[model samples]
Target: MTLSFFDQFMSPVFMGIPLILLALSLPWILLPNPTLRWLSNRFLALQNSAIGNATQQLFSPINPNGHNWAILLIPLLLFLITLNMLGILPYTFTPTTQLSINLAIATPLWLATVILGMRKQPTIALSHILPMGTPNLLIPILIIIETISLFVRPVALAVRMTANLTAGHLLMQLIATAGFVLMSNMPVIALNICIVLFLLSLLEMAVAMIQAYVFVLLLTLYLQENV
Candidate 1:
């Protein structure tokens, strides 16, 4: 039975039960736990140091009041990165490729930031709806445009990630399928295709990490505007 290229994005199941929960929880389990020792193992220490740097950079632009969310957003970044990288392995499903999952993750966090901004500085938050010195006739038009953009942030976040990952996976599958089909009749060409596939795999790995960073970074910028 031939499967469609999009089949890879399908959520997996066993015995008619969804395995998405297991997939979502696996990243946490794969991460190393913090230990009480004065010095951690080299790998764990490196991990901690890297995460610390990311946390500091992410919070630097935001008002200190917003730093409280570092705890939530940092772990979220790690979770997404882990999920994305893990999905690169054979037979693994990428949850982030699903628009529903991405939207669910993004929308609430985005709304929370908006609410926080409005709560802390109502006047300032409302001011973002329209720019200064606008023509009398243009006021309503600008307000309508700004309102639509404001509400579209989360949807943009969801679609950006989903589209990037889905396209990468689709291209990789197409390349691999072509390479395998050509292997018997055109060995040299198939070998060249394999080399190209290998390079594309590396590019996908980088894309996976970068997309995760961009996802969180955009959220941080949104929080910055609010705080």
Candidate 2:
């Protein structure tokens, strides 16, 4: 029974084929396509406006060279948020809950920023390892520490998303199970649990949106340092 609670995190299979592919593609299918008309429908217009605003805010602090990344980053932001929101629905899988997927998404992007810094400004990039002023004895130790911190950034990014989603899902599942159990023996307690579950669902929805934004925002900050 305990294992059943964790089964939700596993990728579902049908006739031996994993349905994760379908889960990933589902969001794109729900999006509205552009038409030939000069004026878009309300849905498209609202989407365009939101994307425009997000792009403006994301790129404002970045250098002109970094602006080229908007094409990649903006789509990633949308994809993550869509997946997160969809996961909140019943009978849906949350890909971001998987550490492998999150790491795959984060590591390459983080590495790209690091590589860009190395290629464009090798001295400045390496200089980040050492402080402006340090005791001669501490220089080596500081470099090692900073290097470890640098490498840990992507790991932290992946873990942060995974941990937050996993915790919320587990808590929701526990509360829901309790509500069901109490419904048979204690009507009043079950009602209270239902109310708490409703509030928690709302909080989880907010978390879904906020986590996606934070992931993109941190990537932007990393790019800002490089470019």
Candidate 3:
């Protein structure tokens, strides 16, 4: 029974091909393309406005040179939010819930920022490893610690998103199962559980949006440091 709960996390396969690719592609397919008309529909206008505001806030701390990243970062924020929200729907798979997928997305972008720093200002980038006026005996230890922390950023990003989504999904499943089992013997209790479940679902929806923003926000912070 416990294993059955975990089965939802597994990548579905059909005719020997994993459907993860399909799941990843599904979000973009649902987005409405901007029309050539002078005016856009309310939904498109709102989406554009939100993207602009978020991009402005995200890049505010970054240097002018970093403005170029808006092209990549804005789309990424939308993609993540869409995927997270879609996952909450019944029978839908969330690509971000997989640790490997999240890590794959995070590590390359994080590494790119690190590489940009090294390429643009190697001395400044390397200087982050050791602070000024350190005791000679502690110098080596501090460098090692800082280096480990630097590499751990991407791992933390991946784990944070994966763990949050996984925990929420598990809790929802547990509550749903209890509600189902209680319905026949105790309809009143089952109805209460359903109410709780409904509220919890609303909370999870908020979490889905917040986690996506948090993920993007952290990436922008990292970029700010590097740029």
For each candidate, the alpha-carbon lDDT, in order, equals: 0.94, 0.92, 0.90
lDDT of 2: 0.92
Model 1 agreement with the true structure over 154-203: per-residue lDDT tens digits:
99999999999999999999999999999999999999999999999999
lDDT at residue 23 of model 1 (Cα atoms) = 92
Residue-wise lDDT of candidate 2 within 8-53, one digit each (tens)?
A: 8999999999998888888888888768899888999998898899
* Better lDDT candidate (2, 3): 2
Q: Estimate each model's TM-score.
A: 0.98, 0.95, 0.96
The CA lDDT at 112 in model 2 is 99
By lDDT, the best candidate is: 1
50-90: candidate 3 lDDT, tens digit per residue: 98899888898899988899899888888998988888888
Q: In every candidate, how many clashes are there?
A: 0, 0, 0
**Alpha-carbon shift of residue 3 in model 2 (angstroms):** 3.8
Better by TM-score, candidate 2 or 1: 1
Once superposed on the true structure, which residue ranges of model 3 sit more than 4 Å away at CA?
1-3
